[model samples]
Target: MSGQAQSPAKPPPELSTSDASGTVSAVAGTLNGLPEDPQMTPLAPPRSTPPSKIPLRPRKIQKLSSDNLKPSMTNLSASAPKPPSSKKNRADARRSSSDALAVVIPRVAARSLSCEGEVETALRHLCAVDPLLVPLIEVHPPPNFDTFHSPFLALTKSILYQQLAYKAGTSIYSRFVALCGGEHGVVPEAVLSLNPQQLRQIGISGRKASYLHDLARKYQNGILSDSSIVNMDDKSLFTMLTMVNGIGSWSVHMFMIFSLHRPDVLPINDLGVRKGVQMLYGLEELPKPSQMDHLCEKWRPYRSVASWYLWRLSEAKGGPSGVASAMAATGVSVQHHQHQLQQPLPPPTEEQQQQLVDPINSILNLGYSEFHFSS
Candidate 1:
């Protein structure tokens, strides 16, 4: 080994400007020392080749004839979309939809006391709920609804009887029925066919004649019908009936109870009912019409029978005299008094007349006979 440290070895040569210009050549020269300048030599022109000697063939063209141009009916029918359904088809579809709905949603049979054993059932229910009603129920015979009259006839009779005494109303009703030919002929058509003069001749007032015509027109227009009225719920029937010119809530209540024999009806506007309720419950003041529903809630599903007892209670207290005093005390008009008197009641028999002076005593002494309510 040398006495002094050997000198550091030299590094390998790096690419410089001269090497890039191809002026210097080394064993590791790039691109074999070729010049990078484009002007160094001109490139040779591309050689041209001669076109091929083979000839091209042309495609043959053909023209379409009239027969080929014409559209095919079978193809058109198969490709075209169908037209919209006709009116008859739409109507049939609606009918089918209605039938399907009818099957899915069953019709509710109307609740009525006129049905067999309904009054008996109602009386049992009232007796069970209210002990006080037992005495009254025991004394009074169950109301009979066997005399089912047509809704139109009942409604017409009720209108004629409004604000009139029973004897006078009965006389007018007889004449009105005769004009229509008979009770069976008292239809909407017959009522509408009668002129105002004809109605006036039968003792119907001008206002009342207008009311009757309005009712008949409603029936003709499909707004009201016997079946519709019979099948309607109490609230809906009240709303519908009150739309007539002269029919009020009081009239509707009477018709529902006496004619339709609906069980849950409580005539709140009725003076007799109010008096009876007051007497039965011993209230300091008469119940407001609005309060009647809440007070009579327990008698539900048989309030009609309970109301019948109340009428009897009112009658037993003082007959028409007590009712008249109540009307006067309440500031009720003469018209209202007449309206109260027009409510359906069986004419007082000789025994009933005697019992009127002391109804409770009479009921306990001589029990009621078979009495049926009708309009």
Candidate 2:
């Protein structure tokens, strides 16, 4: 390489000027004692060339843009896509919702006139807590003015169903009806003439047997006739019915609704009702009676209707639902459902068959047995 000396002073103007010639001239000019124009010079020999990166393997590019492809709603590491919550993604949602409103509008129009305001407020609260429950309750109504009838036997049947499931209770009740006069099972004389020991023998638990007898005695004695219960307020009536043995607050609530047909009764203590609430609320723990009561307070006079809706919701529940499976994704055990009764009674045996066929009334001297159905 030809060595070019670094200039210590500015080049003269003639030397600094570029002429038509292409030759590059190095010269020196000075400011004070220092060079004004810096001449370009080589410092040190060049280092080796920059190392090239290993060429990347070419990837296939997707031709479709985002709009052409279904949008993914999953977490980065997860393969499963979540449900879309976007409005555009939910196009049919508005139509389904409006049709739902159409169904709801007529129902509100058809509600009990006196309790309309309370029903509105309570249902508003209920829908807020559980959007699904509203439609169920709207379709299924609870006991009301038209459902109740004044009779000992009808009310007794409803009480027998207490804490029992719909199907089991229906089966047991059918057997009980056949035991009682069947079709004509509930007259004053039919129950008054029933042998307490005989009724107890027909699969009626000891406590329930006593309850029936006490109820029979009171009805016969005029202590609590149909009128007496109908006129009594909710609290008084519940207390009066609960006075009977084996009949807890639950039974009394049933009696009030099905028999007395009282409005505003809340069966907060019922396991089914509470289970429904727990399921709807998606709770980790089942709520206590106090918590159920506090939550149910908004239901007020329409609590029975709210309860019916909740029961319907409970019926609609699937085992280990999507939410449950999601919760289980974290490897936690989530109790999916709660059964009302343990080890349900088995279907038909000789004892049950005999009880069903037995006479409601006895011969003049003996209790209801040894009597056969007339052809």
Candidate 3:
């Protein structure tokens, strides 16, 4: 064993300058293959420590208390900020809700012309749309009108004035009011108390007497209350009031404009409005009812106001002579359209038919069991 070990260990190889250059080149290539410059920094040492041997921070698991486990509304409320309770906040919310509703809801701008400012704005809009209306506007100041709180009395007066001269109708209305005890006393109950003979004595037609009684009974029975009439929209009121024995479309239109002060009644069946349109545009003939709606579209939302002016225009210079002069000034000739006027009375529905028979049959003493209403 000593002899075998006797071979002396060889000395380490000494590198020459060429070999040193080659070794330097090999080291440079290996350094280039490394992720980072090993020449500038030392390589990290391999870890020998076991995972369990390494020191670590202990984890904390907190247990929930009995109070925390059961979530209470009171606790949640206490944790959160309170909502606003101010009146201003409520009003702002209401306004925002109203604005949103306005987008969804349809607006009836036509009924908004009751105020003076609305009238003026409408007039300005009309003037801007049709320059020809300027002369008519200049010829007359805008009419001042008001709504009658007593729709019943207004409707009664309308019935009495149907087809009669203004002065004569006023006289009959005065007598009728006196019979009912006063203007204020002319309610449904008072009207129902008067017999047909009593109404006849006051110069009311037998048919009109029935109409008055029917109107009174309707009011008494809560079918057509003053409040309901006042609150009804134009089309609804027109439908409702026209169901009465004597009230027709023309009467409804007049009542809507003068009594209810509805702003947008065209009254196309009205001879006065047609005559006014004729004069306003200087057409050779009167405009037809179909054309009336289209021609006077500009006067919408203020047609009642315009109708008042037209009535004035019709009465002025003995009916339409004044309109002619206004037309001559413009020298614009509009085409005349002639169409038959439509009957304002629609066929009675089942409900209306029932109302018609009861109130009307009670008042009229004719041998017949029922009577049909006609305008």
Best by TM-score: 1
Clashes of 3: 0
Please provide, for model 3 over 86-134, each residue's C-alpha lDDT reduced to its tens digit, 9 standing for 90 to 100: 9898888889889999899853375444455777776776677778777
Please report how far candidate 2 places residue 353 from its true position, in Å: 22
List runs of model 2 lying over 4 Å from the truth.
1-146, 159-185, 200-207, 318-375
Best by lDDT: 1
**Model 1 lDDT at residue 287:** 83
Which digits, one per residue and each the tens of the lDDT, describe model 2 over residues 1-375? 248876679766573223312123222223245443344442343478989887698677879877767656454338665454797657667777888898877322223312335445556666775566766656544212333234466556644544443345556556677877683566565765667576666655566666677777777877776666656778887787777665567656655543443446677665556767887778888788889878776555566657755644544452111211122221233233223212322343343222111111000001111122121
Preferred candidate (lDDT higher): 1 or 3: 1
Q: Which stretches of candidate 3 lie over 4 Å from their true place?
A: 1-116, 320-375
Residue-level lDDT for 53 in candidate 2: 80
| C-alpha lDDT score of every prediction, in listed order | 0.68, 0.51, 0.62
**What does the lDDT read for residue 278 in candidate 2?**
86
- In model 1, residue pairs whose N, Cα or C atoms come closer than 3 Å (at least 3 residues apart or on different chains), thus clashing, are none
Worst 10 residues of 3 by lDDT: 361-370
The CA root-mean-square deviation of candidate 1, after full C-alpha superposition on the true structure, stands at 23.6
Candidate 2: pairs in clash: 9-28, 9-29, 10-28, 10-29, 10-30, 11-28, 11-29, 264-301
Clash statistics: count for each candidate:
0, 8, 0
TM-score per prediction, in order, is 0.57, 0.46, 0.55
Candidate 3 residue pairs that clash: none
